[model samples]
Target chain A: MTTTSARAAAADVVIRTAGLIKDYRSARRGRTTGHVRALDGLDLEVRRGEVFGFLGPNGAGKSTTIRILLDQLRPTAGYAEVLGATPAAGGPAVRARIGYLPGELAMQGRETAGDLLEHLVRLRGGRGSGRIGPLAERFGLDLTKPIRSLSKGNKQKVGVIQAFLHAPELLILDEPTSGLDPLLQQEFLAMVREATADGATVFMSSHVLSEVEIIAERVAIVREGRIVDLDDVATLRHHAGQQVALRFADPIRADEFAEIPGVEDVEVTDHTVRCLLRGEPDALLKAAAAHHVVRWVAEDRELEDLFLDFYRVPAGELHAEAEEVVVHGR
Target chain B: MAVDTAARTPTPAPADRNGARADGTRLPVARWVLREQRRSLTLWAISLAAITAMYLAFYPSMATDEMEAVMAGLPEALMSGMGWDRIATGSGYLESTIYGLLAPALLLVFGIAAGARLLAGHEEDGSLELEGTAPVSRRQLLLERFAALTFGLFVLCAALGVATLVLAPALGMEVTSGNILAATLGLWLFVLAMATVSFAVGAATGRRALALGVGAGLAVFAYMADTIGEMMAGGDWLSTISPFGWYLGGDPLTQGVDGAGYALLAGLVVVALLAGLLRFERRDLGV
Candidate 1:
């Protein structure tokens, strides 16, 4: 079922991008002033029936990639294919099979949630109009109440439901759980599960790693508009490697633990043996037992640290980094 | 599975009735766009009707012998500049005041202001994304919004026309009903041409303020050129180029319909719309 196509495994690849580049040109009075490379030679491939988490900090070009995928923004260079077709050429036919939740939802309409949902459903060819009631009920959304009157959480609920209403083949959610309460976040995960169970491919972007870490089987970590790492969620966590520090009762020779398998950077400073350990630490633990270790502190390497290492903004340039995002004009 | 079954809220009122009706039309966005503005459109129509009625009711008192003598004493150039040159006759009085200045001004306001907001307003507030990403193509979406804007203009124009035709005779104003129809049609075409331009600008830029500025800006420039063009070196040329000149210069009230002028206005609408869509298709939205 998966034959490798010219560029990708076309049969199984739900979303694919190759060297996609987007440059934001800041202009004044129709003259280009400067440019920021929002997406720098980004390549991505999302397979069918998988929740692919796009992990990156702010200004890592997460939203830019989502917009390009949705056809809201065009790439300055390269190509993107969603649901077996290039979005630009396919247009509505391609869009019809996809549902997207924008990171920024406009909650300025005067119509009630019910009215807005009904109106949009009709525009989407009225396919999923019947599900609106059940979805609203599940979310505790007062459908009759006007959208402007709703609280932030409730407004986000409206947005969440709308994205799932059509039940398309692919769902691209940008910061889907940003405004939800913990309870609602669970319900949202359930929704994602339901969508996936129905054979939908999910591509969700999040700066917060834990939320995505729970559901995303695989993830791509981006930094400065380029992917620094891409791997299975469990594999990435394993690759992070543990940080271990053992304080011993007796003076210890650093050479004793140096020969232990799966341990490196062994250091002995005043009977405190500290080192970076990978895989099972059983061998190192056995070696440390010989030194009459008084205090053993071994911390499993948190993927959060690794995520931050890959995505953290270099300090002293926060102002400029933020400005690039602002000047990027979304 | 965090499906909180115990907290099941009441389901939304069946399928939305308005939605059902909208789907039947096969032009849901267009129908929905018009339906959502029903209250505002009604208010605009009522206000237009009331204004026309109020203006027409004053014609009898304004056409007395003393008023004619006063009009005669006024300088001809001054009277012409004020759009009140033919104020003595029944048709002339309507032409100079009601047909010439008042109705056209109100229509332009309704057309340009409403037109500019038709697309850009939705776009600026961010709701345009709902339609923009729906199953419909961008081209279909633009055409639907444009159609709704055009139809809304008709409602406003009809309100003014109905008021004039029904109330003019009751007030002893000897205005020809046929000429009234011609003038109303002429006014619709003129205002529509301008509104379409405003619409096209908004569609292309997705900036309501800029779109509105261009719309209002064009109206001001056209009105000035039309109002003062007669005294300028090449006056006849202004009458041909300016929309206001096509509208008030030909004086639809006394002269009846100008077929060529109406055609030009219609043609301008098509041209402006196509130009706007070209940019709309290429540019990024809500930038």
Candidate 2:
């Protein structure tokens, strides 16, 4: 289903990083102490107009990576480029085409939201006034209230507005929906959709899968500064296996169900049989029909298990497992 | 304080957002920096006016012979040590106390506080992320912010100049407007030196306490080097390098423009700002 237009669009890499490394040096009493590696040879390629999700737990170098792309933090070693220009060498001209939302936003002033936005718009030297009204109205943001008086959600809305104000070619948002309520999260998602429709690329990072799973075409799960898992949402859905339990009218051979394709971890106690069903369940279901079916129950397997497979393993072992997953995924 | 951003457009932006074609766009970052500081600047200006008026208004009373004898009766070493040499004459009284001592000292505190807060405080509080990622370059951000700091300090120092000119005649201080300008200009430049020092430290370190400590510490050391060091044998050279020495030692009140004072003090301000910019750009921010 890849149209020529889609193929052409997918060829452009909006952001690229290779062998990127960032190490933070700690100090005690002015003495040099050991350092923590925030990023270890991380690589990424985000296609144009794609909603790429950067997933990681806290202290996983998610923020560190975003900051490096924005040239806010220089990498200890390696390279990063945005829109064909090295982020550090891109200068302001390159950044002018980018919009960023910091994860830990700090807006302190007596200025009202309107005042802050106006100042921000002026700072970018853009005609952002056009986007301000609709974005604010859509988010149900009160523009006249002083920024300090606004609630956390309201402050986050302001951050959202400023990020989209200029309609930059690329948007780098770090936990953009942190304080939004569920309903507002929907509105934020819709806004992101419209932004992408207009040919803008979105690179959003989140620790949770709910939002990212909905919008992202591809996602990279980072752990301890390296990408442990990466896959497409479509592939992710296919991997969403379910745990199935069936109670037969009489005792039957549970070993038979275990032998079937796409069924795993079968266990039986007298009349009931339990197993995991991955992909199509037709074969497993048909096999169960031969026996009396008294009751059947199934629950979707937790996605956390997929992440646990990566997160719990030691780094050296995870590398081989991660490569295997990637190889089998495609 | 909003300079038409047009007038201050930074060194022709290498290129506009669209391409290599540069445009004559205004400098909004500089204006934003100034706007952010307006409230603090207002408070500092108000305090400066009140203190300057209160101290200058009492100059007439302190100019009396009785007050002069009282100042003299105090230990000569203590009086001379604090630079309170001539209270009988209006010029001497103004120079030794208000113009020379209190105004510069208070201005130093204001400058250092603002300097520390300018970059380092915002960086620590995590507020610098907004401007840091804005389409503006670090050079523009640094210079524009420093411009705001420079503008804020300059305005307060200029107020001291104007207030003294207005009060000198009413208080019967035997000093011309030109003399007040000369003396206040020295103080103003001296304050700029210290403010830039603090600002440079903050920009380079991204630590408010370090910036504040280093700035305030330098002010104390410079004050000592200029005032107390003179008493020590072979210590006369200390004032030559100290900003306080550049202002007070030259006695700009009596000696019209201290060309050397203006040059050296202004040189220090420029050097600090450029050095800060170079360091700030080279180092990792938000550390």
DockQ of each candidate, alpha-carbon based:
0.40, 0.36
**Tens digit of per-residue lDDT, candidate 2, span A72-180:** 9998999888899888899778887888898998888778898888778767764465466667777889899988899989999999889887777899999989999
TM-score of chain B of each: 0.88, 0.87
lDDT of 2 by residue, B150-263 (tens): 888888978777888898888888788887888888888888888889999999989899999988998998898877766665778887777888877877777768888788
User: Any runs in candidate 1 off by more than 4 Å, and if so which?
Assistant: A1-10, A250-290, A312-330, B1-25, B231-234
- For candidate 1, the lDDT comes to 0.80
Worst 10-residue lDDT window for candidate 1 chain B reads B4-13
Model 1's TM-score against the true structure: 0.89
Q: Show pairs that collide, candidate 1.
A: none
Off by over 4 Å in 2: A1-10, A250-293, A298-305, B1-25
For residues A1-330, write the lDDT of model 1, one tens digit per residue. 124443454558999999989888887887899988889888899999899999998888998999888777788898888888777787888887888888888866578999888877777766567778888888889999988999989989989988888787889999999999998999899888878877888999999998898999889887777776777788777766788999988888778888997787788898798988867779988887776778878887777876764545573354364344233322
